[model samples]
Target: MNEPFAGAAEKPIPEIWYGIPHGYVQVDLDPPVEQIEELVQQVLALPDGLRAQAEPVVQFYAGFVTALNKQNARACLLGMHLDEYDEPATSVITFSTVPAHGTSAKAIIAGTAADTVDGSAHPLELPAGLAYFSEEERRTPAPGRPAEGSDGPLMGDIWQGTVAVTGSGGSEIVVIQLVTSAVEMAEDFRNILLGVAHTLSFSDPSLSGDEAGTGAREPEPDSVVAAVRSVFG
Candidate 1:
């Protein structure tokens, strides 16, 4: 049987479009074993001694996709960023839609913000219609300076940014979620997300790939994916 998000078929109707910068790569839950091997060895640049660890890593992301798909996700992308020291190398962004049916975009946005605990949403100025940005933190680590008790927490913190907007046709609500464990770099993540959010547009659902001169800046570039493609192929 085909696994969840394993090369999901393209939807034929008009869909939402946005920018993905150079550091991100789209995820595919299922791909050939050979490609997976190449992903560990090449894209990730993992050493041969750690070769056996790739399977578990793949399985973790498969579960991640499965969770999103269960909630009506439309697309998933993984970001592997490396600084001068390659710190905080992973982040994830997911695009999903909630059936608006007949609900007003204001109600949807307000209700979402209200439901969140300690949720704060602010007006987002964008080309897209009626958008709000909300941030939520789950299982935050112990409150203290980073250098002290850094390893005390059994689990790392989870940070997420939810960007909700009215669908192009008012029939659905587009939700773009950005998540990462690097809570310390929240400001950087927020800036990156805004760059992407500004580019949002509703377009053909079956829009195969990034088209030239469409004013759609790719969030992830083709060259960035050549290696990432193997990881999530």
Candidate 2:
């Protein structure tokens, strides 16, 4: 379930924009140390059961966000859905851009889906404007081999859904990637992710940002929220 995006501080016009559900919180990529420590303190104050569940989710994203920061990710969101999921599952959503080279959008989508080695990808039932949609589930070993005495999965399976759309006059592709470890919820997440992707659009400077301008395509906050929930709820 989701609510109208209450609103966030004004920022530069984004190349791509999409909506996520209520269970998710956007990770402030450039927050002061105090903000992060405050979050940690809140988690610590939770009851043992809730704290135990939240701690790992926080840590997992801490590491993941660190990696994304180094890659200069555009945006990041974290989802913790203990009630809706079988376990205390976590989801990481990120936005990033990649060069389109000279490839056509359709070809990019097909190639991306075809490259799903461990899982599968395809076009959405409702197309999201020459978008690339994909789902993958795979296990990648941790950076280093496990100790000799170690057992079980050294790393773990990774499940993710991605949506990519061309922007900046086709010079680049903006990607929306959502990753979670709850493999069992893959289908549900795929549905929810598609719902979000369906609402995505690239900001067009040429279009009217003014109320009097014709062909103004700015999204209404409420409509985006409604679209994302149409599939999941």
Candidate 3:
């Protein structure tokens, strides 16, 4: 249970967090937790020019954490940028969980797949009774002021997955998200996302003490490169 994120607990703020039931899972990304917090603090301390660009992302992280807390996620891995920025940026892998009251894994898969004509959904073949995958493109026009690079709209891709596992005396849906800025990088991002999700293992910490289980974990050397390449490449 706590063994997985033990390093997080060692930090002053702790990068890894476990939920009350400890039914969900977590995977460490680059920069960890303390670095992300420190990055945020540095951005906040900046004067006006660069701070304006980074503020939205800082706010977004705050709001996202709030949302996950409200959803009663038992454990999660926080991912974010460690460097300064002038505009809003997205996290690489955001994990969270919510109660699925009788929601069939098939229903979740179908609904997620139906969101895009080009996207496909398939079973994860893991311990979890149900798992789903979906990939899609997103577009955002320049609002008021354009983002750093382009003169027009911005395009990005999102890879999402869900695993339904019952443990900790209840059932929960594990949500995985990989967001990047392009269509060409979809496949790469999807592979990395699946790697993380495939490693997910659920257990009832209340019943099993400190030992939680694991799934078919994939060894990804340089996860940071995988994440960045998915967007920049």
In order of appearance, the predictions have TM-scores of 0.64, 0.66, 0.48
lDDT of each: 0.64, 0.66, 0.46
lDDT of 3 at 177: 62
lDDT of 3 by residue, 137-202 (tens): 655442255479866665444434343333222344556565554335456546656655544444
lDDT of 1: 0.64
Cα lDDT over the full model 2 = 0.66
Tens-place lDDT digits, model 2, residues 95-198? 77676678765567667767867555665433336665777789966434577888854787888888876654655666778888888888867766776666
Clash count of each predicted structure: 6, 0, 3
Q: Which regions in candidate 2 have their CA more than 4 angstroms from the true location?
A: 1-14, 32-63, 83-86, 102-107, 110-119, 124-128, 141-148, 151-153, 204-226, 229-233
Q: By TM-score, how accurate is candidate 3?
A: 0.48
Candidate 1 global TM-score: 0.64
Arranged by lDDT with the best first, the candidates are 2, 1, 3
- Winner of 2 and 3 under lDDT: 2
- Can you list the residue pairs that collide in candidate 1? 14-205, 15-205, 20-218, 20-219, 20-220, 21-219
lDDT of 2 at 77: 72
